[model samples]
Target: MYYFNPDMLMMNGSKMSFEEKISVLREQLASADAVVIGAGSGLSTAAGYTYSGDRFRKYFADFEAKYGFKDMYSGGFYPYETMEEFWGYWCRYIWINRYAPVPSDLYGRLLELVKDKDYFVLTTNVDHCFQRSGFDKMRLFYTQGDYGLFQSCSPGGASKGRTYDNEEMIRKMVLSEGYRIGDHGELIVPESAEISMRVPSDLVPVCPDDGNLMTTNLRCDETFVEDEGWHQAAERYQDFLRRHKRLRVLYLELGVGMNTPVIIKFPFWKKTEQNPNAFYACVNLGEAGCSREIADRSVCIDQGIGEVIGALGV
Candidate 1:
């Protein structure tokens, strides 16, 4: 195992020894009161939930020819003419991300490292990896929607007013035993055998009380659902911040990118700048760096999360 040392600081263009980086991280961890983990797609990528390659081919090969999308993200936005095709792709996506085991043990290692710390996670990843890896569900805020949820579409009093019973959706999808046309010729079931289970364009998911179109609880469009659960999680996140504002908090950012700087980077920069007792650490394979203002309290380790977690074996 590599050990970090104080004199291990290297120039920007120069390579940073993993041992030295680990030592620095250990020191930061030792003094941290509350650890806030900010994650992105890169964290999932490290765990082997890659958007393309064998995983994508296995689930979406059929649609690739028709839509030319190589990954699930692009596939989500693909203009499928039928709901059957759309649901077919999404069901597979949800199954793989929500039910399947990721390629690496990175999430588990992360859980182990933060198990003893007063920690909270704010992640944009929709895969539910942190919970699967044994992190406390209450301590996590999945800022984005989950793969296992389905919502209703209705113009509510909010900018995006939609609601869903995620449990019901998961149960229905899993219990349908695979997508098949019902007696009324409605697609319901897994798309493994039948790729024709398209969600109807007119299909508005209704409240059990009122007939309305159902939608996913995803934060993609204006109709994204911001239900009570979302607000509660946001409150928990705020509470965590307020409780640790004056403590030595460690803002550990992993695999975050510029796609949503406001979510991860901007907040990290602001917090570290405001709190003298705070430190910011970022670990990204290729994209790793921090502003000079927080240079003394920041460490941008240009390494894969899995490798770093392994080096920090709990």
Candidate 2:
């Protein structure tokens, strides 16, 4: 129901030097009554979880050779011939993105910046990076489904209405493909000849209830399951916003692009516009900006999130 009027957006912080914006953000963080972070793919990308380039080549070269897809994102959408092939690609995808050690301490640094404040994170990322990096789970809400969970795809399966953890199965799937687990839980590719693009038929995950295939818990379609946990997190987020409606709140948006503006971008704009005591800030490499209506109360820094966070000296 949210509408995005491009004409209302502006990179008004363009007038301020990067250093000035950083200073303002730091001061606001220290003084604001609460902070609500809206994170997207860019934040994880800043933390070295890129979907393409070296990371993609390192983990997905075999996939690229087998299929013509160049990046992880595209590979997700590829119509594989069988469930085995699909799960093979997805298991590897989940292992690297969800279980592997974070490449950088960006999330930890971000946690430090807000750990002392009353803050809640609203992220589109499914990597479980925030929890893995030690952010309070109670204060975090993963609006999109997780990479580490799977839900029954069958119409009437016993587990149809729930999500199940995929860690154990994903690890097994990756290990089956000759990828070894390092001391720190990183995936190590085995010899070239041992790599595989399909898991064994028996290794493909299935719903225990009716023996049907289980799909990722991601919100790709209406079939996406929002279990009890999801509902609770949504409730908590609503409560947080309600409590801070009239407070000196800071909407700290990080690396959120235009992919799903209604979830984070537009809501942040609308909330900031409603509260005179609220401040809105965005940290994105290329798409940093704010609604022109709230330009005076916003700061949109067009810089890498890591660089901006580093400059904050927090």
Candidate 3:
């Protein structure tokens, strides 16, 4: 049911400066009955979880040297010839993004802004940043799946309607690649020897129940599993929306982009339009905006999320 409609996109060329918009956002957050945070990859990027550049180079240098992909995102989709090689790239990818510590406290600062309020998170990001930073698990909906989980490749099995946690296996695979775990759980490249670009054949993950190949729990295709937890979270999100629909609600969007607007962007716009009491605020680096129909009730701050959240001083 989630579908993007380009015609629904709109922006206002407001005369209000960034300072004025920040002031308005602060006022709205304080007064709104509920806050529904719609997050995306950009928020993670803002929180120092960049998918490219030095961060990618630091962890994925072995894979980069072998595959020639400059960024982590590109490496994720590379068609490796063997499962050992595939898992070699992905285990590190999942570990650093999901299990390792983030470079900054941006998520914590964001939580400070809404810790006491009735807030629910709906994010496209697979990284476990929000929960890792102390956000309540029951109050979040990860629409794009998670990096810390794996799903069964078989259509019918005990793994049906289930997702397996990958942390233990990811660690095993990383260690198999000759990487060492740092004191703080970060992956450390061994100083004395080169890291392997492939995992041991036995390290490739398989479904426990059916012995089938396991895939990343990300939502790239129809095969993505929607387990009981995913369903419960979806229902909770709907309940939250119903309870706040006509009240003073703030659709606080952070770092969302146009890749899959229907999941968060379009719905936020639609809901804002439907409820006169609703206010929509977007804080993306460049894609911040709302429908012109609801322009008067919206604020689009095309600024970095970390800067805006920091300025809020919450």
lDDT tens readout by residue for model 3, 167-244: 899999999989888887888887796788889998888898788999999888888999889999999999999998
Ranking of all predicted structures according to TM-score, beginning with the best and ending with the worst? 3, 2, 1
How many residue pairs in model 2 have overlapping backbones?
0
Off by over 4 Å in 1: 1-16, 155-162, 166-210
- lDDT per model vs. reference: 0.74, 0.87, 0.87
* lDDT by residue for model 1 (1-314), tens: 11222222464756567787888888898889989999999999999898888878866777787778788789988776655556656756676677656667888889888899999999999888899889998998988888766665664544244455454443344334344434532334344565433444333235553455455667887767766777899999999999999899999999998788788888887898899999988888877777766777877788888888888875
lDDT by residue for model 2 (1-314), tens: 22232122234533567777788888889899999999999999999998988989888888898887889999999999998889889888898899989999999999999999999999999999999999999998999999988888853557756888988999889888778998888999766747888888888888876677888999988889888899999999999999999999999999998989999999999999999999988888878778777877887788899999899874
RMSD in Å for all candidates:
6.0, 3.0, 3.3
- TM-score each candidate: 0.84, 0.94, 0.94
Model 1 residue 156 lDDT score: 54
Candidate 2's C-alpha runs over 4 A off are 1-14, 155-157, 191-193
Candidate closest to the true structure, highest TM-score: 3
Higher-ranked by lDDT: 1 or 3: 3
